[model samples]
Target: MDLEILNQEIDDDEAAYRVRVVRRVHYLTISRKPTAVLDIDTLCRPYLLIPKLPPFPDGNWTKMRISQAANGETEHVLSWDPLDGIHSLWHPRQVDVLSLKRTADHKARVKEVQFDGRILLSKVAIFEWWIPRLQRETEFYERISKDHCLGSGSVAPTFLGHIMEQERCVGFLLEKIDGRHPLLDDHPACEAALRKLHCIGWVHGDVNICNFLVHQSTGHVKLIDFEYAEPFEETKAQLELQKLKDEFSQMTER
Candidate 1:
């Protein structure tokens, strides 16, 4: 869909602005100056367009434009601020837009996307709409990357980048690991990885077979889904550690 913001009329007394937006899709151009063209899929319904706006009380609207950067490639720079409420459209350069293929439909609405011709997974959490689970997961990945406690071989999928909405991180990108069939043979390595993470002052609060991925060829185990992970306390960590040990012992005995 091609959306063009023709012009904005602002009323300073009421602090409100009326915006005119023209929507065009399927090779249709709406306005004289169409700032952005969005190719949307019909299956993805109830499309949510979060506008990134500048700070409040600026009282200025920046028109969306595509300018040639030093690299000579055109960059889409869009900024919009409307008065009725706080509505701004801004897309950060660092955020990568993935083609969402599937949705988990859970509270967090975990999504699967194809990135760079490969299946990459993503999870989104709106700043105000949803709880802060996505943000927490992002933080965990960042900390793990910096601390380097978990060995590179056993680490979960690589953290790609964040998905931003309105200048805030609402989602994150992660490497998708295939062949995640559950196997008791991978239990020991998964336990070891969790132990390493705990030693770094964190605990994977939710630990199960599903969160452990076993590489079909190499048998390497990678721990994933750290949304429930939290800072480790000596007492609680010990209890959880023992529980994990018992679980693995039973699996091995079988």
Candidate 2:
């Protein structure tokens, strides 16, 4: 859904309450504009499931969707006139997520986010509403479309992006690994995949079964989801390294 925050103001009576011009959300597939206004607090409520949060007044990356970039050429669908449609998210720095209201509509529900209007990114995902951390994550994936994990196995998004409702602040875009199935035990295929990732120094923060996809036809496996991945490491850095090794062993054994 297309989301745009216009202007925001605080209520004189309450510290938590505020009024803002919330642009009507539009499903990218259907070019519709927001026809209503929404009032919310500068501070969003605790709904998004975050184990810990970054220091306030600061912005961190979050995942919003998991999808592969659409390959076939089609008319561009997610564009709007600057004067008519609200184009981007509010700046992430200026706004804080105090409360999030879930929509009844499933489609609208997946694209909604709860954060202040302060922090915003210039790059907006025209197609998807997931991956709040990086707008248009699928678009970003397009940048890495040519990248490969093992020697021959091809990788791509398996599903469209989806929002983690429990963790309202985060979003994810999953890729479809067309014909590959994840290696269950220690196998050469798994080792090659990890070796490839290590050669590039690319880290997969959450290396679990759910985070992987296998192509049945080629035995090619593709990795997806980067909600928690970062080049910079902190306390659990070694653990991440170990996890990669473990995955290698598991696949080799299979």
Candidate 3:
């Protein structure tokens, strides 16, 4: 049996899909792209189909499949594009997040906040569609705060504490830093900042210039946005590293 997402178009608030049954084959490999999108017609073994509830985090990062990159070598397969999708969040920002109100997708500074243990907290993480990213990033920062990370791990903003709702930890508080995105001239700073993370045996998955913050006065660099970051894998890291290199080099070329 074959289950294919016919189209991403919403049909009564849910995506419409199609299932097909075909003849036998030797090996079965699943690609992230649908067959129709792949524009391929191949016979598959007809098998029993059973629908079941999906596990929590069905879309977790653990699920890896063949996909394409932007402005690069990609087939006309309808791959999962994170850059796509209509962001119609019922309640974009979380309720009572802070006096100024912020979302989990960005970084902002509020007045110095003090918790029960007299710990200071300024930066905050709110619940939103970025819940998974926030949780994973917070945990990574926690390791840095406790000096349990590799390399210096000091390239990240300081972790103050967790934001609590009753007894549940819904968000986190991190140290606020005033900085700007790296410009073409600040490419060296970007490389140094990225090298720090690589030295720690992790890759800064998103190698965009916007993710590298250059200090306003001190001119130091820090890395942010760990939504796609993971432990270092030589092959993948090299590709991402080249992109990091290209970001600056390309600007210079232009």
lDDT of 3 by residue, 131-150 (tens): 56656666566555455552
Query: If the candidates were sorted by their TM-score against the true structure, best first, what order would they fall in?
Result: 1, 3, 2
Highest lDDT, which number? 1
Instruction: Kindly list the per-residue Cα lDDT of model 1 for residues 1-254, writing each as its tens digit.
Output: 22322112222221111122332101111121222222222111223221422112222333343334567544544455421211211212235332345433423345677666766677665223343565566678767777764344645677776664334455677776764645666666777767777777788887766677777777777777787888887876778768766777777778
Candidate whose TM-score is highest: 1
TM-score of 1: 0.55
Of 1 and 3, the candidate ahead on TM-score is: 1
Q: Estimate the Cα RMSD of every predicted model relative to the unseen true structure.
A: 13.8, 17.8, 15.9
lDDT of 2 by residue, 1-254 (tens): 12232212224322111112132322212111131111232223322211122221211222121112345222222333221211222223222222333222213213333233321112222223234434333333433443432234433343223322222323332322344345455245554654445444445567665556566765666665544444434444557556766766676677
Model 3, stretches more than 4 Å misplaced?
1-129, 148-153
In model 3, the worst 10-residue window by lDDT is 20-29
C-alpha lDDT values of all predictions: 0.51, 0.35, 0.48
- Per the 3 Å backbone cut-off, how many clashing residue pairs does candidate 3 have? 2
TM-score of each: 0.55, 0.35, 0.50
- Candidate 1, residue 71: Cα displacement in angstroms equals 59
